[model samples]
Target: MQLEARKIGFYYKKNRWIFRDLNFTIDAGEIVGLIGPSGCGKTTFGRVLSGYEKPQEGTILLNETPLPKRGYQPVQLVYQHPEKAVNPKWRMEKTLHEGGEIDRELLEVLGIKQEWLSRWPNELSGGELQRFCVARALRSNTRFLIADEMTTMLDAITQSQIWHAVLDIVKQRNIGVLAISHEAALLKRICTRTLTIH
Candidate 1:
């Protein structure tokens, strides 16, 4: 399986292209890093790849086909801000189960305590909430993961734990990962190859 962005272009305003004619691909089981300076549209590209936003030109293809308009998307995105990603009204358990049934082993690997599941999103620390967001995005149907600065805000220990769990799952499931971040050391540690946006 492969997720390919073919000659894609996007802009939020007229005559201002954040990125143009960009082509990229991530094959199944590969970990690709997207690294660039701040405000270079790396996050925008991730959104487009994950089907959260539409590109102004070109296409995003999964296995040479356009992405599905509805239903569970194979390309999932885990953003940097878990607080903004989840609903405030729902408990952590509900949010975690939104994608599908929660994998007990996954929870244990990510260091998510069973007691935390009963708490609200606002009740958890940033790192704790992010673990849930990561877990939710790794549902069985996910073919690719677009992690846009997913661990940037967490401390070194938390970041290491999350990446360890994520990489383990990626290897076991053969899921491709697109890691977007400005941290060169982190990228070098986890990604097989790196793509620069600018």
Candidate 2:
């Protein structure tokens, strides 16, 4: 399987492109890194790739076909801010299972305590909440993962834990990963190959 962005272009304001004519691709089980300075469209590209935003030009394709408009997304995106990604009203357990059945093994690998499931989002630290987000994104149907600084806010230990779990799953399931980050050291440590934008 492959996810390909062909000549993609996007912008918030009219005619002022954040990125233009960008092209990228990743194959199954490949961990690819995307590096760029802030405001250079690294996150925006991840958003477009994961179908969160429509590109002004070009196409995002999965195996040469367009991404599905509705239902479970094959390409999952886990961004930096776990707080923004979740629902404030729901408990962590509900949020965790919102996509599908809970995978207990996954929770264990991510170091999610069973007790935390009963607590609200605000009850957990950013690192703890991020573990849930990462687990949520790795559902069985997910073929590609777009991690936009997913562990950037966490401490080194937490970051290492999360990446280990993600990499294990990616390898076992043959899931492709696109890790978007500004940290060169982190990218060098985790990614098989790196791509720079701008």
Candidate 3:
């Protein structure tokens, strides 16, 4: 399977385009790196691809079909900020299971403690909250993941741990990944190839 962005165009305002007529693709099991300057719409592109936002023009296709509008989305997105992605009112466990019943093995692999599940989002550290986010994005039906600076805010050790778990899961499930970040070294180490946009 492959995810393709064909002639994609997006803009916040009428004439100003964050990106226009862009084309890109990532095959299953491929870890593709996306790098660009600040305010270039990389994050916006990810949101569009994952069905969080609609493109003003063009289409995002999965295996030549439009993304399913209902049910679990095959394309999942993990943003840079975990705090913003999750609900403060819900406990970690509720937030984690919002999609469905998450596998215990996945929780174990992500280093999510049983006790942390009962606590609110604020009670946990950034890394811990982000762990739940990553696990949530890796449901069995997820065919692709758009990791927009997913681990940028964490320490080096925390970053390594999260990446290790995520990489292992994606490889096992043959899920495609588009890792958007500013770190060239990280892209070099994790991605099969890197794509840059202006």
Candidate 4:
């Protein structure tokens, strides 16, 4: 998977531009970090890259082509708030099942047992909830992942676990990861390549 953004412009409100004529390209087998001050549209940029939001101008091309808005395609997004990422009514199993049937091996890597899979989102703690969210995102078939502050709510140890897991996924799958965050220390810890936005 390859993502290229050129001269893109976006904004949430009047007279303020989040990204203007911004440009970057990430090839397969690479991890790109997007960092900036708060509300500089780092998450917004991640959304546009993942095809979850539209950019006011410019485009996000995957494999040298534009991505369709709807399909059984890949490229999953794990947002900052796990509460919003996973359905409150759905069980953990339901979350991982979206990409397909559950992979037993992945659960082991995430240090989660099958029992917890049946529980509702509310049943899990913040860290656990986000981990399950990661599990679900990994089940997708896409070769790229946009993680927008997905581990911000967790403790240091939990954050470490999530970051390592994500990096492991990237290495094993040979996929590109676009990790968005305002935490410079965290981004530097995981990203082989990083860029500051705005």
TM-score of each: 0.98, 0.98, 0.98, 0.92
Q: Tell me the tens digit of each residue's lDDT in model 4 across 90-133.
A: 78887778757757777778777678888998888888888887
Candidate 4 is scored at a TM of 0.92
Candidate 3: segments with Cα more than 4 A from true spot? none
The full ranking of all candidates by lDDT, starting with the best, is 2, 1, 3, 4
**Model 4 pairs in collision:** none
Q: How far in Å is the alpha carbon of 51 misplaced in model 4? A: 0.7
Candidate 4 weakest ten by summed lDDT: 67-76
Candidate 1 lDDT: 0.94
Candidate 1, residues 1-198: lDDT per residue as tens digits? 999999999999976999999999899999999999899999999999999999999999999999999989999999999999999999999989885797799899889999999999999999999999998898889999999999999999999999999999999999999999999999999999999988
Candidate 2 overall Cα lDDT vs. reference? 0.95
Output the worst ten-in-a-row residue range by lDDT, candidate 3: 10-19
Candidate 1 Cα outliers beyond 4 Å, as residue runs: none
- Model 4 residue 21 CA deviation (Å) reads 1.2
Candidate 3, 100-134: lDDT as tens digits: 98999999999999999999999999999999999
